[model samples]
Target: MQTWDVIVIGAGPVGENVAERVVASGLSAVIIEAELVGGECSYWACMPSKALLRSGHARRAAAHVRGTGVHEPTGPGAGPDVAEVLARRTSFTSGWDDSGQVEWLQGVGVDLIRGHGRLAGDRVVEVSTANGTDRLQARCAVVVCTGSDAHVPDALAAVSPWTSREATSVEEVPGRLAIVGGGVVGTEMATAYRDLGADVTMLVRGQVLAGQEPFAGELVTASLTERGVDVRAGVTVVSATRDGGPSTPVRLTCDDGQVVEADEVLVATGRRPRTDDLGLSIVGLTDGQWLDVDDTLRVQGAQWLYAVGDVNHRALLTHQGKYQARAAGDVIVARARGTEVLAGQWQRHAATADHRSVPQVVFTDPEVASVGLTAAVAREAGHAVRVVDYDLGAVAGAALHADGYGGRARMVVDTDRQVLLGVTFVGPDVAELLHAATVAVVGEVPIERLWHAVPAYPTISEVWLRLLETFGREG
Candidate 1:
């Protein structure tokens, strides 16, 4: 039996951040990982997917420029360098190696247990290792940062369709690919594979990017359609069949009685919190359900247990998970030291940001970035809200960015408080411009204060200025 001050059950980004924070506070910590130490985002979801998307974005950016360096259309309809894009993705993922991550873990003085870890009881964890089973105990905290797994439809799962893992890490692009879903994962993957020279079709059961501002979805759908992706909205896949293994083509029958054939099919339906086998029932909780946690990120029923990241279901994005992890770790350390933990919103030991300012970016061709509550949500929350819109294309910076630039910007303001409640940006290369909006929303900067923070000349950020002006003009 081995004992540590803290034990983290998953070594994904959120878990790593938790361990780092606890260890930095002078607590001994151990991270138990069954698979790669860096987890899904490092290799499959975030890194590789972004690597795959960047080349196409860069090519389009260059092609739009009138300079000599503009990418001349090559091949049929001027396609991207598929071979180079895949190779770059491989490089970004370090050929799927976790050695660098392991080395960093070691350097941070956080011990690692390479096995499957589950709660044996209160502070006890039983790990199943290749050598044998081992019982480990944590004196301070046992954090479940197990993250989530791709949620695939039972009908499609039977056909062994690709999830985000296979979609991002695929070695070869299929000639024809079908993506079933219109959310972030499905739309992003559709953009990536289609740009990688595959004939892509997307079957969306709901409106594309359903939860975001409608225009965000509309713009993404327009771009995907203009790029030759067959996007079928309001269509659900009733069944899918593939018998000849992974290489075999998958035939999907939709609810609308439409049959689509593809060399490969990817199901990006949703995600399920990974809490089924973590022995949650032993802790007086239901199995296979998202863990409920307080503002301090401590499990509601169990005082010593904490659940962060997707497991808590607060926000599923990687950065938001990391944000939660930081607060959770600090709370654990404060309790261990017998210090009073701050419970105020946005305090050091509270995950207030998860509620009010969770920012997200979808890395499609025309990127989508949003933070805080939309106008509909703000109104639903009982806020007297005013909305503002700006044409990103009309901004001097956007026009200078590319020929025939197009995009839209929106802001939802709390009229009673004179502060921003939400902001959304949809356009080319807008991913980099999200932080400014995030700060505005999170800081709750008043509309009057915002007017003085002048945007530099001819920049897409000028859209911020335009949005504020629009709000004033409307008022």
Candidate 2:
């Protein structure tokens, strides 16, 4: 039996952050991982997905500019060499290896156990390794950071549809790819495969990028259409089946009685917590359910148990998960040493941003970047809100960035407080403009004070100035 100050299940980015933070605060920590130490984002989701999309984005950006001798590929064998792109993507994942990640953990004084970990009881984790079973105990806390898994509906199960994992790590681009769902994953893979020369079709039950500002999805839909994707909105797949072997094409029958065939089908509908087999029943929590946590990330009714990251269902993005991990780790340290815990909103030991100021970027052709509440959400939250819109294409920097720059920017302000509640940008390279907006929203900077934070000339960031101008100086 081994013991540590903290035991973290799953060595993903979220787990790594928690373990590292706790160790740095004079506590011993150990991470137990069943797969790669770096988890989903490092190997399957974020790194590889972004790597696959970046080549296409660069190609399009260069093709849009007048000079630099870049042109759209003309022949059947033209466009980005798919082999090279996959190679680059693989490199980012270190060929799906986690040796470096393991080394980093060791360097930071965090021990690791290569196995499956489950809660045996309060602060007790039973790890099943190749050798045998070992019981490890945490003197302070046991944190669940197992993250999430892609969800494929039962109707599509027979078709063996690809999830985000398979899509990002695919070796070869399909001749035809059908994507169901128009959220971030579906839209991104559609862009990547289309740019790699696949005949892409998207069947979306509702608008793409549904939770974001409607205009963002509208613009992304337009861009995807112009780039030769067949986007069918308001379409639902009633059933899907593959007739033959793994190489066989998939047949999708839609609710509208439209049948679609594709060499590959990717279902990017949603995610569910990976908690079914973690022995939650031993701790009085249900299996296969999201673990509920307070602002400090402590599992409700369980003082020695904590759930961070996607397992808590509070902001599923990797960055947000890490943010929660930092707070959770620090607060655990404070509690263990009998020190003061600043648990107030926006305090050092609180994850307030998960509710009020989360920032997200979708790496599609015209990237979608947003932070904080949407205008509708702010109003629904009982805030008197004002929405300001600006034409991103008209911004001088946007015009200079690309010849046919086209996009939009929106700011949702709390009229009663005269502070920004949210900001959304939909355009090429607008992702670079998000942090400034995130700071403003998270800091709750007054509208008048923002006037002094001038943006540099002729950059996409100039949209900030334009947004403030549209909002006006007066109440």
* Estimated TM-score for each candidate: 0.98, 0.98
Clashes of each: 1, 0
Q: Give lDDT: candidate 2, residue 449.
A: 98
Q: Can you write out model 2's per-residue Cα lDDT over 52-128, one digit (the tens) per residue?
A: 99988998799889986898765555778899999999999999899999999999999999999999987899999
Q: Which pairs clash in model 2?
A: none
Q: In candidate 2, how many Å is residue 26 off?
A: 1.0
Highest lDDT: which candidate? Answer: 2
* Prediction 2 TM-score vs. true: 0.98
- Give the runs in model 1 whose Cα sits over 4 Å from its true position: 69-77, 243-245
Looking at model 2, which ten-residue stretch has the lowest summed lDDT? 72-81
For candidate 1, give the lDDT of residue 422.
Answer: 94
